[model samples]
Structures are given as structure tokens and as C-alpha cells.
Target chain A: MSRLFRSVSLGLFLCLGLLLISWWNLFAWSVVPVSGADVLHAFTSFNDQTIAHRIVLDLRLPRLLTALLVGACLASAGAIMQGLTRNPLAAPSVLGVNAGAALGMALVSTLPFLYGALSTSIAAMLGGGVAWLLVMLLGSTWRVGANEHGRLVLAGVAISALCAALTKAVVIMEEDQAAGVMTWLAGSLADARWQTWQAFWPVALISLIGALLIAPSLNVLQLGEDNARNLGINLLRSKLLGSLLVLMLVGAAISAVGSIGFVGLIVPHIARLMFGQDFRLCLPVAMIIGALLVTLADTLSRAVTYPMETPAGAILALIGAPFFIYLVRKRTL
Target chain B: MSLSAHQLSVGYHGHTIVKKMDLTLPDGRFIALLGPNGCGKSTLLKCFARILPAMSGEAHWQGQNLHHYPSKQLAKELALLPQTQPIPEGIKVKDLVAYGRSPYTGFWGKLSTQDHQIVEQMMKQTGTYELRDQLVSELSGGQRQRVWLAMVLAQDTPYLLLDEPTTYMDINHQVELMHQLQALNKQGKTIITVLHDINQAARYCDHLVVMKAGELKYQGSPEDVLTSTMLKEVFSLNAQIHRDPVSGTPMCVVED
Candidate 1:
């Protein structure tokens, strides 16, 4: 038991170290480079006249905060979804959540009346809710016994493909909005700002707390539905509340960061590999791992290309796809 | 009465499996539900355990409707062991058994010292104490079955419902488990199980309920219910029934 606590504390400390490094990296290695001393001076004593101060306060801080929050939110949501479906491959992107949220945001952007971050997030939540309901309806039709994981994956892929096609069709019809939509869909953190963090943090906090609260029920759920029901878990209520929380997390994330992928898909897997499968331990660790993963990826994306920004999603998939294939070969999923 | 189903109709998706059947299960008795495949034995057991909702009528616990009882309160009264449980990946036996304390534990599911002692006691009772640290996936089928039984026992309910609990065990282990359940019955726990083997059911269970095609064919002692003609009618097999020499219970030998 002490060993387990030691390992968890070690993992937490490692995450904190990485988060500090990410903060340093965010300040030090942007389009306009600032030295370590410059970063310190800018943070400790602010002057509007200094270029370092301007960059750190206006650009780096918000972008750093956005990446951390969005990453944590999406990854935690992915963990919950995996538990809900009892399928490890279940992620927001695979479940058509990202696509649905993107579609909602896209539509809201085009509409004259709905033009703010809150409206966009609300629309995204509604879209994600619809996708979740459809998946539940479709998933329930099948018996979902031994091959439930594979069948649900197939259903998710089909729904994702349909949503992707519809989103593309909508974007193509509007020529003026196409560039912004295309960039957002590619998932860059270049435009992250204070407003984005302000719009997102409450939802992220709610989601994190909600996931922690439901972690015990999820443990019972992993024993299967009948056993869980017999063990006094209200299956329908747990599942419904869990899915709603996932939607809030994913919706807030997509709206803030514009559909960053694979953090949701891969971070939970890595967390499980490091920690055990107990959700009480895994949920917090998953959030930490998620924050670390995206922060590193976003920092590397900006640094590798210098002035030209690269989408973090592209970098993540370049790494994530191979890992996914390895998992498939191992038959773990 | 431990559990009584009144005008109960159970099914899925508007199709009924067990329809409008009324029955009362007596407390502190070892009961066996025997039926052929697709005869609704499992479905009926699930209904009594409250895992499935009755399509028409009420299932009662101590004269109150089972549905009316709060789920946690009901769980404290009845423990169910379903067949074909999925093992969560990389879970240890001790951790798995700790889940049984969820009803008594608060929202965080933290195991108190008393809860841990109960879990340990259950593990020892089911002979899974040695395997507590091992991962579930690393254990063999029989060992895994015992571990699951320990989990159910850790729930420490007064009434237990098990559907084919002996599926993966060897003959020796099966008899051992039956004796353990008998010990539990002697301690005043009501045990209702669905069993495949007629001889084992007859030897171990005091009361027998036989079903055919979702309807109750017989409900009595094994001697009264396990007749050769009733065996042929219910199981569609030719069998000879005789009293066991050791226990004086009805034992059947199927004639091919």
C-alpha cells in the first residue's frame, strides 16, 4: 500500500515537473524568443513597454492555460467514456463528439444572432448530446456481449464519417468562412487567448469534479451491468450523468481549442499503463498526463516550425496512430 | 417469504419470457431452479434479483414491493451472482472484493477497517485469501469463479441468487462449493440457484422448482419433483430416478 502511494506521488511530481517545464517553454520559445532572465523579469515586474512582458502576458499565458485545461478536460472525458462503454477505444473523436461539436460551432459562427464563445459552447454541447443519444440508441440495438467493443467502434466510425461529411459540405458552401473553419478543424493553438480560457475553465472544473464523484460507480460498472445493478448502482442514472459530463468537458474543450485530437484518445491509455485501472487513482493521473502530453506537443509544434505554426493534432496523430496499431496487434482493445 | 413474484411477467423488448407467474420462495432454504436451455430459468432468476424489471406485476421482499425498496437497501438484503462476468483488466482479487462494501461505504467507496475485515473474512471463507494479490486475468477459470463468489459473499446479504455458479468448476470443486453454500444456508442465508446437474441439485438443494418453456412445471422437494416421468416431460429425456444411499435424496441416471 505504501508502495502504491509512493508510485502515485512519484507520477504526480513528474507531472508537476513537466507542467513547470511547459510553462517555461511557453514563455521562452515562442515566435519572438525571450531568454530565461527576460521571462523572469517579465513575470515578476510587468512593464507595458517591454516586448517580453507584452508577449508573456498577452499571448503565452493564455495559450499555455488553454492547452493545459483543454487537454485535461478532453482526456478526463475520454476516460469516463471508456468506462461508460466498457470499451477502451471509446474517445470523443471516435464517438463523433468532436465532429458534432465542430459542426455546432461552425453553424453558430455562420449564424448572425449567435456570435459569442458561450453560444458556441452551448451549441457544441447540444451537438455532442445528440451524437451521444444516437450512439446510445444504435448501441442498445445490438446485444453487446463479447464483441461489444468492436461493434461499438464500428458504429462510432460510421457516425464520425457521416458527421465529417456533413461538416465538410456545410463549410464548402460558405467560401468566406472556409479558411477559418479549415484552420480550426486542423486544431491549432495559435489563436488561443485570455477570452478562450475565461470561456472554458468553469466547464472544465465541473467536468473534473463530476468525473471524480462518479469514479466509484464506474469501478462497479466495470464488473458489468447486472453485477453493478445488483450492487446497488443506478445504471441508467450513472450512465446518463456520466455522458452529460463528458459532453460538457468535450464541448468546452473543442470550443476553446478547436478540435485537438488524440489527447482524448491516447492520454487515458498511457495513464492506465502507468497507474492501475482503479478510476479513483486513474482519473487524476489521466488529467495530469493529458495536460503534460498536449503542453509538450503544442510547445514542440511551435518550436519546430518557428514562425510557421503547426497544428498539434497533426503531430499527435503522427505519434498516436502507430501506438494505436500496436495496441490492436496486442489485442488489448 | 424471502421473495414472492405476483402475476409477474418478465421479458425484453415487448416479448414475454416468463408470463404472469405467481410464486413465493420460502426463507432459509436451499432452492434450485432446474430447466433446459431457453426455458427462462436465468430470466426468472434475474427478475427475482431485481436486475430485470417485471413486465406486468410486482416482486415483493418481506411483503413490500422489490421495486419500492431503495436499491442500496435492497442490495443489503439480496446478493446476485450472474453467469459470465467480465473481469476488469489488471484488477487484483482483494480490490475486486472490496467493491462489495459499496453499499455500506459512503460515496467515495472508501473501505473502513471493518469493511476490510469483512472483505478479508469473505476471501478466507471462499478460500481466495492466497490469491488476493494476483490479477484476475492471471487466475484459471475455477480460481476466477471462486474469486467472484468471494465478491458476492463479501456483499454479505441475507438472500443470495446465483445463475449457474458452477459452470467452470471441476466435479470436486463443484461439490465443495455446494457444501459451502449449504453451510451458508445453515447460517440462515436464503440460497436460490440455477443448476444444470440434476443429481447435484437434488443432493444439495432442499426445495426444487422445475420449469418448462417459461412455465412452472413443478415446485416441491426433490423426491416429489424429480420423478422419471416428470424428467422425461420437462427435460425431454429418458431417465431413471433413485434415492441416494448417502443422503437419501433423489438421484437420476439418464438412459441413453
Candidate 2:
């Protein structure tokens, strides 16, 4: 119980820390100089004319908010995947959602008539959903008696490779049409605007709430299939809702911020290590950790190269890849 | 209002494991499902627990179709423990057992005071109270088995279906588990267990159900069910029946 209290406090502290980091990210290392007081003033006063106020409201705020949402969506989705599959290595990126979404974005943006944001986002969601469906089907994840964990992961790896290869082929064939997509494909936060955030949050927030509502069901799933069924949980409903949540969360985040790779893979493990395997608790903690990690990484993306913005996704990969290796060495799977 | 099966055929991947069969269980009895390795005892138990869908027929609970019954209500009526349990990482014994209160708990699965008491009582009954705070992945095999039993017991159901419940237990724990189950049986909890020990089954169980090659071979009291002819026909064992000195139940003495 004390440990639970401690972890709860830790999560609250992380939230506070995230608020601070987000505040710092709003003004620090921007090409257009802004201040903390300017940030508060932009919120408190009418600021249609001032350049600094426009920069604060227009450019930085949306970027910071998008980073936070992308992190929370990916991390919570990762937690759900791990709990449902009972595999610690399970994440959206590893399971082909990221690669599939990228392939969808590449295909849409490279074509002449289909070059629109809303259409590309839809394509990403559909591509991710279809890819995940194929993985689940080929892996035989829902089948009984046969060992499915290893097979499921293997299927995801194969699908990811396939999607990535297709995306590369498309990008190479339409280099002039895909010039703008090249930087976005690197997972940068430079292009977020008020219009995209308006479209992004409502869907992302609803899916995040849905993820929390199913937290208890994810806990029950840890008991394996037959045991969970005996506990009165409708297996088909829970699994389907879970997979849908993953696609929505991943699709939205990947569409908003090109494919932030490692937050989903790493944040859930940290949450479970600190809070244990109870999804109700670990899931929210994972969201906080993910938001903080991405926000902090986005802030650091400015400092890493200074004045020349490194892609925040590249920053996350730098931190995430070694951690991935560490996890594989520490755990058997 | 009894647990019954009607021409049930259950399988997976289009391969049938249990063929068409019809049977009904006697309520408030300690029942033992005695069968050889491939006799479909566990499969039948799973069908009753609603863990597996029957391909052709229906399993009935309280005169209602088992599959059609609401999942939460069926959970309150029946609890099942399979042969093997996955050891979830970083879960405490107390919290693990508290999961049994899921059907009775609210939407978020928060255990109330009464739920806590039942969880405690079950942990104590299973001799796992001292290990309440220990991680499940850290416990030994026998200890883990007891913790799982405590979890199933904490479900507080009237009907229980256990498959090979005593697999990793020692001799003392095996007998202790039998005694505890017998006590629960006396208190009107109908436990149907697939047990390998014929002598132990006869000693504690009020009814015996023998199966062979997916067929129901016999069902009767211990005294009538432990005949040498039935033994040779079902288990391919040549055995003589004798009364147990300690329990006065029919015991099987094998002839080499």
C-alpha cells in the first residue's frame, strides 16, 4: 500500500515536472524570441497584433501540445498491447503500426490528386488497421492452445519490414512530389499549427479516455485467455476494442507528428517497473511518463544542435534504441 | 436447476476433442472426474465453465443455456482453475487473489471491505496469508499453485471446476488440499475435479465419473466405481479393490 502511495505521488510529481517542461519548451530555443511572461500575457490579453504573442499562440503552443498528445497516445497504446499480448516487447512501432502508417502517408502524399492532410490521416488509420489485422490473423493470436506470442511478434516484424520497403519504393519513385514529406517522415514537430491541433485533440482525447475505461479489462487479460473468460470478461469484445484503441491512438499520433518511434516502446516498461503490472495504475503512469519524455525530448531537440532543429523523433530514437537493447538483454523475450 | 450437458461436442481448429455426450451432475456433491490421459475430462470441465464453445450442443447452468447466460452472473455461479497458470510479472499474492472478486466488484474492480475479508479468508485457508506481499514470479512451484488455488477460492462461487488441481503439490499439501476441498464440499460447494489419484478420489469424493477415449464409461459411488474390471477396461490396469483401513473407502490395490 505504501508502495502504491509512493508511485501515485511519483506520477503526480511527474505531471508537475511535465507542466514545467512544457512551459520551458514554449519559449526556449525558438528562432522568434519569446518569454514566460509573454506566454502568460498571450493567454490573459487580446493579442491579435503583437508578433511575440502570435509566435507564442501560433507556433510553440501547438507544437508542445501535439508532442504531449502523441506521447500519451503511443505510450498508453503500448501499455495496452503489452498487457493484452503478455509480451513486454510489444509496442506499436515494433508491431508494424508506425511503419504501416508511414507507408500510408507516403503513398497519399506522393500521389498528385490525393495530396490532402485529412485524406492522408485517414489513409494512415486504414493502413494501420489493415496491417494490424493481418498481423493478428497471420500470428493466430486469437487461437487457443497453440503458442501465439512468439508467432505474433514474428508476424509484426515481417509486416513492418514489408510496409517500410513499400514506403521507400514510393518515396523514391516520387521524389519531387514527396519533398515536403521527407522532413515530416523524420518525425519533426516544426509544422504543427492551430488547425491540426483542433482536429487532433478531440479524437485523441476520446480514444485516451476509452483506453482508461478498459484498464480493468487489460488487467484481467493478464491471466491468459481461459482464466480471463472464466472471470466473466467477454474476450472477443475486449480484444476488439483494445485493437481498435491501438489503431486510433497510433493513427492519430503518427498522422499528427510523423512517426515518433520509441515513446510507445519504452514508457510502458518504465511504468510497469515503478508501478507494477496493474494496468489501471501502470497505464496512467505510462501516459505521464510518455508525455514528459516527449515534451522534454522536444525541448532538447532545440538544444542538441542549437538553432538548427533536430527532429524530435531522431532525439527519441537516440534515447530509445539503447534502452531497447537493454530491455532485450534484461528480459528473456 | 442442475448443471447439465446435452449432446455437446467441443473442439478447436475444426478438430473435435469431445464428441456428442449428454450428462447431468448431482448438486452439492464432491465429484471426481477420473479418466485416462486423452479422455476429455478437462475439455468437458471447460465446456461447463463456459470457457470453450460447444460445436454442436448446449451446456446448461441452473436450467439456462450456459453460453446464453450473462458472463458476470455465470461467474458468480461457477469458478474454474485450469491445469497450468501463467505467472504474471510483479504481482503480489494479495492483489492476485483479490482478482477473484472481479465479478462482484464494481466497474473499476475495487475490492470493498467484505471483498478484502473474503480475500484474506481464502489466502489463510490456502496457507498463503504469509506470502501476501511476495511477488508471484518469485514463489516456488507448490507455493504458486496454492496462491492460484487461493485466487480461485476467493471467487466465492457455488460451483468449481478444477483441472489437475494438485499437479505440483507435495504429498502433505495434496492431502491438505483434498481435506480443504472436502470441507468446502460439506458446506455445499459443488467441486468437480479431474484427479489422477484414484485412491484419493475415492477417499474424499461423494461421486465418481470415469471416462475413456472421450466416452463416459461409468458414474457411481466410490464403492461401485472402483471395480477391477472397470479399471482394466478404462485405465488398462489390472487391479484388485479393497477397503481402505484409514477412511473405509474403496481402495484400488494394483496387481503387477
Candidate 3:
């Protein structure tokens, strides 16, 4: 009972922290300078003519909302991947999703005719789906069991390498079109608008709910494959649904912000430390923490350069790279 | 109301372990599958539990194909405690035990009041109630074993299969586990286990099934299966058989 109380309190604290940061993000280091009240007036009373209210309504609000959803999606996807693979290091970046999406974005942004044919987000989704499919097939999880977790990770690494190389080649070849790809590749929320949020939220929300619904099966999976099967989990079905959910989440986030890395990797371990291993509890807490971290990073990004915008994803990678090293050395894990 | 394997050839990959074997396991009895190393006793138990698919034959339960039952329905009827489990990180004993009721729980795995009662009862029966709030990873080997058993018991299956349930325990813990399993079997569960200890199996288990190199060597009551010649033929050991002073069942005394 005390643990439950503690979890609830911690959850409440994280939520409160997210709100506090969101407020800070609205007014802090704004190029057009808006106050908290101006931010509020944009929501309560709309004035298209006033620049402050217009900046708040048209730019900052959508960015804030997008950051929240993006953070939530990535962290949940990380937690799900970790659970499904039974590898502590499993994340969208490590498992080829991010690289594959980057490759898709690179191809679309650089190849003149192909770039115009499809939205980068849809292309990203398709590419991630294909990469994950290849990883799953190479892992041969169906004929054998999921005991080949190590093999799956190896396959992901190889695919990520290939995709990264292809993306680099695309960027180098099309120097003129590379400017847009470069900023997007850094994973900035600077260009976020209401239209982006409108396209991103519905899919992100459905995938979030899907992640929550599968939490129980993922819990059983933690017991290992043989035991999971004994516990009534259809291993292939659970894994298929889990991977699909991950692609949906990661595809949406990468498309929205241009391949934000490390939030997916770092947030899940923090959530597990705070809330224990039950995904039902852990994923929600991870979502809040992810949101909190991204909002904080976004807030700090403006202040970091003071009037010049910095990509929130770059700031996250700054923290995430060192954390990854720490996780690699944390043998007890 | 029966569990049997019909020409069940179970194995991993293409290598057949238990090849085209037929066996009818009697219901409502304490049974043990005993064999030398590589004999496939463990493989056979896994087949009956439906954890492994039979390569070329069928496992039948209650007059129907065991493979045909939906996994949830199968889970409600049978439970397996594998020889080795990687202790789940950060799972509380009570929560792990509650997972045993997954077949009966909602999609979110919320236990009903009756499920709570069953989980409570299982913890008590396995003598792990005191460790309810404690982490499974932090428990001692004996306590961890009992906690896992509590989870399996919470599954509330009449058919239980355990693969080498006492691999890492000290003699005292091994004996204690045997006693606990006997008590559970007394409640009318069809308890089937793969055991390494010949003397332990003979002393506690009412029925014995012996296998050697994937073939059924001998099976009957302890009196019928524990003869010195059977041990020599099946186990490749020249061992003498004598009555156990306590249970009066045949016990093996390996020749020096």
C-alpha cells in the first residue's frame, strides 16, 4: 500500500513538473517575447492581429503540445522494445527504427522527384516498417523461439549500420537539398505548427493506448519465452503487435521532429528505477518523465543560444550519449 | 479426463529426442519421470505440458487434441515450472504470483477478488506469504523456488509439471520441496516432475516412469520400477535396491 501511495505521489510530482516546464517553455527566451499571461490569452482569447498572442497561439503552443506527445511516444516505444527483446539496451535507435526512418527522410528530402511524391512522415513509417520486418526475419523468431534475443540485436545493429551509411551517402550527394535534411535530422521542434500536431496526435494517441493495452502480455514476456508461452501469451502475436506499436510511435515522432534520439533510450531506465518493472505502471511513468525531459530540453535549447534556436534533439543527444556509456558500464544491470 | 502422448516425437530443431513414443499418464497421482542424462524425460514432460510442440505426433488431453485448445484454455488446465528461470527484475513476490492467474485475469491482468483469494492461498500453501511484498530477485534459493511454485499454484491447474524442481537447493531445501510437492499431490493434483534423485522419487512419488535415450524403459509403482537390474539397464549403474526404512518403497544404493 505504501508503495502504491509512493508511486501515485511520484506520478503526481512528474505531472506537476511537466506543467511547470511547459509554462516555462511558453515564455522563456521567446524571439517575439511573450509572457505567461500572453501565453494564456492566446488560448482564452484569440487575437490574430497582436503579434505576442499570435506567436503564442500559432507557434509556441503547437511546439509545446508536439514536444509532449513526441516525448510520450518515444519513451513508451523504448520501454516496449526493452520488454519485448529482454535487452536492457533495446531502443528505437539501437534496433534500426531511427536509422531506417533517417534513411527514408534522406531519400525523400534529397531525391528531387521522390522527395515530392510522399510526405517524409509516411515514407519514414514505411522505411521503419521495412527495416523492422527485415530484422524480425533475419532473427528467425518464428521457426525458432525468441531465445535468439542476442541475434535480433545483432541484426538490428547491422541494419542500422546499412541505413546510416545510405543516409550519409544521400546527404553528401545532394548538398543543395541537404540544408533542410540537416536541420530536421538534428530533430528540432522549431518548425512545429498546429498542422503538424493535427497529423501527429491521433496516431500517437492510438499507439499509446495500444502500448498500454499490451502491458500485461509484456509483463509475462519478462518471465522469458518458455514461461511466457506457459502463461498464455501467444508469443508471436504479442511480439508482432508490440513491434507494430513501436513502429507507429517511432515513425510518428521521427516524422514530427526529425529523428529525436536518446529520449527513447534514457527515459525507460529512469522510469524502471522509479516505478519498478511492471509495464502497466512503468510505461505511464516513463511517458510523463519523457515529456518532462523533452519540455525541459526544449526550454533550455532557447536559453542555450539566447535568441538563436537550438534543436531539442541535439540537447537530448548531448545528455543521452554519456548516459549510454554509463549504461554500458553499469554491469549490475 | 486423460493425458496421453500418441507416438509423440518431441524435440528441438530436426533432431528427435523422444521418438514415436506412446504413453498414457494416469490422472490424480503423484508421478515422476526419472532417467539418466540425455534420456528425454524432461522433453516428454514439456510435450505433455504443451510447452513444446510434438514433432510428428499428437498429445491428447481429455479426449481432444491438446494442440487445438486455445493457449489460454490450455494454460488454465496445465502449468509448468521450468528447471531454470531468469529472475524477473524488480517483480514483487505477490505480483509474480498473481501473474500465475494470467489465464483468468482481464486484458490488463487485474486479478478478481476470487483470484486474489487464490493467490493468497497459494502463497500460504507454498510458505511464501511472509515474502509477499519482497522482490523475487532478492529471495534466497529456497524462498525463490517456493515463490515460483506459489505462482504456478495460483494458476490453479490440476495438471502440474515441474522440470527438475530441486536443481540448486541444499539437501534440506530439497527435502522440504519434496514434502511440499507431496502435500500438493495429496490434494488430487496430477503432479508430474522430472527428478534427478532416484531415492527421492521412489520414496515420495506413487508412480514412476523411467526413460532411457528417449524410449520408455519401465514404468509402474516404485516397487516395480526400482529393481537393481532395471537401474543397471536404464541408468548404466550397478546399484542395489532395498526398502527405504521410512517409506518402505524400494530405494537405490549404488555399488561402490
Candidate 4:
């Protein structure tokens, strides 16, 4: 098959698979009534006032959409981060961006002043920005020679741990707010209301678009720092711009549904395996696979308990950890 | 256009590696920079290519300080192929070569028809056209080196700088790459390369710059500089020099 045809077909397959999973979860949960012809009935019925429609549209649909959005955001952010750092393992969570957003949300939630919905997101954005700045600064100082890849990874790990400690301390101080913060920290999509979706979707869309626009330069960057510079790619400007896009995507996703893990870490590797290493091709494929993986996880979360839903974050961990181990054993990453 | 370094001092993090190095390459000359390991030949070449920051002196290209030109314009003038492996994993050979056009491209740099033609010609010239669809990681050391050279060739610059471009290859591929570079120089592209092989440097280069411990030991034609005295002083080796049977270039035989 031609490259374009193969890519388009793969994309359609992923979209169809997500749709099937969404439908299955809806029927299994009795969110749409479990009839003998549940698939057919669910497709045809559109009574907005019915309990089934209300549950499917108001509750399940928003959560699903949130999962898809956050997953794509995290995966794209991870891909961009990995490309920028030129480290295969670099991701938002590993590089401290997620921890920073969580810290920001935790702080804002405890504020005595009445913080409206927008305040939490703004705080999360600031936290993500600050964390990235800290990583860059520390990494720069620790860079021993021409190769800074190892130093940057170490700096990211150190900063992530520090941010996690601060976040934990804040949680301890405000024990009452701890319950809400805990669920967010666990990275649940259950609380994704329409308002939360409104807050995150635009940032994710804009940043993803921006990332695709710069995808070509990323190929130049993969050639290493000196060669990329020789190609007339302004290394500093490209790094800063790419990091900013990552910050926006990751910060918005984290603020919407706190610290969803594994999607960022695993989706890019999977995309690289499936689509080869071209960033132009890998970015979109990663986004689709990211959406599919999270949606599948969210569907399993809703059905695993039947009536009682598990947090999608827990399901991702349960699925992702073993898959990650398998990848390591296979030496694919 | 010509490239000249005026008392150039280059190094990393405050320690000068190449100091007070003044050199000039007239347009279209094949210049070889020869030195022992850690003798600062690579540092000097990097300074000329603007890969390393000039610590205290100037690199002038076409009568203007190279530092004054924007990086894009500078890249358009010169290309460097540092001795390094191609990025690991599935980077296609054609895509790797196309990176040479990056300096001339805009933000959404689509490969123009001319750019594609140049890349195709470079691949053909470097004998990498057959491997255009192949992954760089799968190529042998010699083939990978040629692909890298093709990438630099696709840049279509007037001057090309290569740092030990013959490091990992066998004698045959090494000679082939040097011959290709000589051909390029003959086509009016000024070529400056750091070479470890003394005989290769003597045979291929129009001019030779010999360095010892970060300072110039000699600079002139290979016939003038690759003498027994200078070779022993710079390389700490006794060598006998003879005219090559074919090219009439200096041929060296080390004394035991």
C-alpha cells in the first residue's frame, strides 16, 4: 500500500475501534439499556429526556471525550518532549511537567480566596511553566560536555521528585481538601464536566496544531545538536517553542484531569514502533493511538466494576505497567 | 569565496584548544589539516564551520567576519560533516540527505524541485542512491560515511568541512571518499578536512596545515610541509618521503 493510504486506513481503524469500545461500554453499563439488540437500539434511540440517554450523553460521553482529549494531549506532549530532549524516555511525567501541574492544582484548591474554575487552570499552567524552567536551568548547569541528554534526564527526575514531595506536604496540611486532591492526583476522568472540557479542549487543540506545524524541524533536531545547528535550525528557539507547546498541552490536560499517567510515557513508543520514526508521521499516529488506548482503558474502567466505575487512571496503571515491562523485556523501547 | 581564520582561538568552557591559529584557504583548494590525537585540528575546523564559538579570534569568509553573517547564511556558504554515527533507528537515507536543504528552506520547508534534484544528484554522486530507501542504521560503516558525505553534498555549499571523515572506513572506501572530495574541490568547492592518515593527506590535499600541541608547525604545499624533519617534529616519527608513482604527490614511508 502507498504510505498515505496505509496511514489513512490505520487512522480509520483506530477511530472505528474507539467507537466500538465506546458503544460496548455504554451497553455494558446499562447507560444505554441492555437489550438483545442493544447495539441497534442504542444507535436508533435518541430520547434526550430518558435516563439512558442522560447517562450516556451527560456522564459517559463527556468522560470519554475527556479521556480522548487528555490522552492525545499527553502523547503529543511526550513525543515533542522526547524529540526536543532527544531522549527516548522523556515524557511530561518523567520530566516534571505533570508533577508541576498537580502541585499547581493542589495549591490553588487550598487557596482561601474563592478560586473560580479558571483559577485552577491558570495555576496549573504556571506550575508546568515553572517546573520546565527549573529542569532546563538545572540541566544546563549539570551538562558536562557536548552531550547533555543524560544530565537533562537526571535533572527531570530530581525535579519531579521534589515537586511530588511538595505536593504531598500540601495535601497533608489541608487534610480536608485531600480527598478531592487525591482523586485528581490519581488522574481520574470521572469528574470531567462540560465546563472542564471547555477549559482543556481549546488549549490541547491549539498546541497540537502548533506541534504539527513544527514537526518538520524536529527531524533536523534528531540529527544531534551540532548538525541541527549546522542545518540553520536555531536550536534555542526551536527548543523553547517546542517546550512551550508541550507545557500548554500537558498543563491543560493535567489541570482538567490531574496527572493521568502512562499515556504520555507509552503512546509515543508504540507509535514509533508502528509508524517508524518520522515525527511528521509519528505525531498524528501517536495522537490516535493515545486516544484509542485511553478510551479502551476508560471503557474497561466503567465495565470492570459493572455498576461501580473504577478510576481510568488506576486501569491505565494496571494495564500500562505490565505492558511497559513486556516492552523492556522485548527491548523495544 | 575564500575562508580565512585570523588568530583564531577555539575551545570549550574557557580552555583554549586551538590558539592564535591563522590560516587561509584560497577558493577551490583541497586543504588537509593533520595532527596527532588531541592536537586541536578538529577544534580549528569546528571554529571555521562556526560549530564552536570562537574564543578570541575571527573567521572571515569572503572578506567578512563569518560571525557577522546569520547562521542560515553561513550554512548556505559552508557545510560540515562531523565524524559521528547517523542517528540510530529508522531514518531513511534520502531524508537524512534532505536535511542539507534546511538552511535554504522556510518554516514549512517543502522540498522544492531543485532541492529534490540536488539531493538526487548528491546521492548518485556519492553512490548512495541505491540505499536511498534504506535505514541509515542498517548500512555498514563505509556506506554510512558516504551517506553522511552525500548529506553534506546536498547542501551545495562552496566550502565543505569534514572532521576525520575517514575514521572507520577501510582503505578502499577511505580512498574513494577522498577521491570524491577531490572531485568536488575540482568543481570549485573549497574542501577543508582533518585527516589522520598522513599518506592520504599528502596524496589528496593541495595544501597541508600541520599542527603540534595546539599550534601550527607548518602550513604550505604538502611537498613543502610533509618533509622528514616536520613529520618527525609533529608526529614524533621518522619518515622517508618520495614522489608518488602516479599523482607525483608526496608519498611517505615510516622509518623503523
**Best-fitting candidate, measured by TM-score?**
2
lDDT of model 2, residue B87: 84
Better of 2 and 4 by DockQ: 2
lDDT score, candidate 3, position B234: 91
Please give the distance, in angstroms, between residue A150's alpha carbon in candidate 1 and its true position after superposition: 1.3
- Ten-residue segment with the worst summed lDDT in candidate 2 chain B? B10-19
Instruction: Provide the RMSD of all predictions against the true structure, rounded to 1 decimal.
Output: 2.0, 1.8, 2.1, 3.1
- What TM-score does chain A reach in every model? 0.93, 0.94, 0.93, 0.89
Taking the tens digit of each residue's C-alpha lDDT, what string does model 4 give over B108-159? Answer: 7688999999999999999999999999989988888888889888888998
- Give the CA lDDT, 0 to 100, for residue A113 in model 4: 59
The fnat of each candidate, in order, is 0.86, 0.86, 0.84, 0.63
| Candidate 2 lDDT tens digits, B96-190 | 99999999999899999999999999999999999999999999988998898898888899998899888778998899989999999988899
DockQ of 3: 0.77
- The DockQ of each candidate is 0.86, 0.85, 0.77, 0.60
Question: What ordering of candidates by DockQ runs from best to worst?
Answer: 1, 2, 3, 4
Sort candidate 2 into its docking category. Answer: high
lDDT of 1 by residue, B1-256 (tens): 4698898888877889887888888788999999998888889998888777888988889899987788898888899999888877879999989898888899999999999999999999999999999998899899999988998898989999999999888989999999999999999999999999989999999999998888888998888999998888998889998889999988998898
Among these predictions, the greatest DockQ belongs to: 1
Comparing chain B with the reference, what is the TM-score for each candidate? 0.96, 0.97, 0.97, 0.95
- CAPRI grade of model 4: medium
Tens digit per residue, CA lDDT, model 4, A55-129 = 666666677778888888889998998888777767887778888888888888875553454477778878888
- Per-residue lDDT tens digits of candidate 3, residues B87-148? 78888999999999999998889889999999999999888999999999999988898899
Which candidate gets the maximum lDDT versus the true structure?
Answer: 3
CAPRI-style grade of the A/B interface in model 3:
medium
